[model samples]
Target: MTLSLFSQFSSPSLLGIPLIIAALTLPWLLLSLPSGRWLNSRMTTLHEWFIARFTNQLFLPLSIKGHKWAPLFASLMLFLFSLNMLGLLPYTFTPTTQLSLNLAIAIPLWLATVLIGLRNQPTHTFGHFLPEGTPTLLIPVLIIIENISLIIRPIALGVRLTANLTAGHLLIHLVSSAVFTLLPSMTSIAVLTAILLFLLTLLEVAVAMIQAYVFVLLLSLYLQENC
Candidate 1:
């Protein structure tokens, strides 16, 4: 029973191989790529349009130097969105729910932005640690606080994603389990629980999409700051 309840977060494996690899790769396969033909299919056209719009909106605020990262940002956004939405299916694992995986993704990208800032404008980047018009005594304290906040951004990114997904999944699991348990005895209550489950499922779907967008949006914001 315990295993069954917590099993959703566990990485599924076959023999000695982990299925997380398949999960990570599956989203890319599912995306329809444009062909070499003069005309495009409806799905392909819509896909291209959606990506184009997303990239435009995302990079609209950034400078020309930041425009170069449009491809990476768009691809990461789609990859995360796909992973999140797909994980909502029954019997699928959510890679984003794993803190390690989330951290792995967040840290590298976060570091890249920071490195870009440091490399291109080291003085500007360092200047972020200490704001202007600070008093003599508070300067040291403010600098420490600012540095800590700067360092915590990636960890915050990872934890926010992990915690939200994990909490939602657990709630769904518990509610569904309750529905099953109650259905055999309490018909009316079970029906109500089922309705709640449906609503929660819908909420989860929205959350899945929003979280993906938020993750990418925050990255873009970071890029905007650095650029």
Candidate 2:
């Protein structure tokens, strides 16, 4: 774990690890600039159509109109979702399965949740932190607890993705190793181990999709609560 942490951060520039962060973030920046209007324009539709003809279809299949934020948000979600799913493929890495990458994606989401909440409900911003009805005596304790829990959201998100991906990979690797050790000179055993690895890879792909959906669902919930 410690070595992995060091390796992820050793590349201090935006070209590597930071590039992963940038890939997750650049869409947000593009989305933020247009007051959600530009994304819904005809030009944007044509652009998306053209891109779809060339790249994989990762955009939302449903219509997203008038809501300026939907297209951009959808694009970001698809990109992250696709990237997360890619790691399930053989000989490929899932950048978001790393602690640093998950944290990088989640912290901004947490911040956006807070800011959007505040922007939409200024007077009720702090109030949103606490449930509307609570005993007067319990308000302080509840406030503190809620605040801490809110802070833990991103941390938990990071740890969850990292642990799931790392554990699944290790499990598959260990199983393969065991199969090899048991039948070092047998092609049959080698073929059997390869098949098991392939099956496990499929399972991991499903898990990766689940993890990404979990992250996105949590984020959408946060936004919905705040808005």
Candidate 3:
């Protein structure tokens, strides 16, 4: 029983090759493909609407230069949203739930944004380390603090995704285990717990979607700053 709850997250492998590669690729397979005709299918239309809305919302705050990031950011949003929702299904493991994977995604993107800032506007980017406020004594301390914050962005991004998904999944596992255990002994209580589980699952669904959005949203914000 304990193993059932814990083992859901264990990375699955076959013949020394991790199956997470399959999990990551599966979501893209389910997405609607573009057509060459004037008319589009309902799935294709809905997909276009969602992509348009998300692109507008994400890039609205960025400078003109940031417009170039639309494709990358939009693709990331769809990719993450799919992965998060798919993990909720039975017998499926969430790749994003793995901190290593999240960090792998976060670090390079974060570094690229920073590099863009430095390359395009060297003086302005370095100026961010110390604000314009006139505090002669606090300059060194503030510089250190801001620099630390800069370096920690990727780590925070990875940890936040990992922690939220991990917590929600663990809670779902616990409540589900309770529902099953109580069914044989306390039927009435089991029914109540089942109802609660249903609601929690719905909330988990929303969390999964929101967390994926927030992950990408923060990335865009970082890009906006650099742009």
Residue-pair clashes per candidate, as listed? Answer: 0, 1, 0
Query: Which of 2 and 3 is the better model by lDDT?
Result: 3
Model 3, 172-195: lDDT tens digits are 989998999999999999999999
- Candidate lDDT scores, in order, read 0.92, 0.66, 0.92
- List the RMSD of every prediction in angstroms: 1.2, 7.7, 1.3
Q: Summarize candidate 2's per-residue lDDT along 51-86 as a digit string, tens digits.
A: 464223332332232133454445555566677665
Q: In model 1, which runs have C-alpha deviations exceeding 4 angstroms?
A: 1-4
Quote the RMSD, in angstroms, for model 2: 7.7
lDDT score of residue 57 within candidate 3: 87
Across 7-83, the per-residue lDDT of candidate 1 in tens digits comes to: 78999899999999999999999889989999999989988998899999999999999999998988898899999
List where candidate 2 sits over 4 angstroms from the true fold. 1-67, 185-195
Model 1 Cα displacement at 168 (Å)?
Answer: 0.9
Quote the lDDT for 203 in model 2.
88
Worst 10 residues of 2 by lDDT: 58-67
| Sequence-dependent TM-score of model 1 | 0.96
Pairs of colliding residues, candidate 3 = none
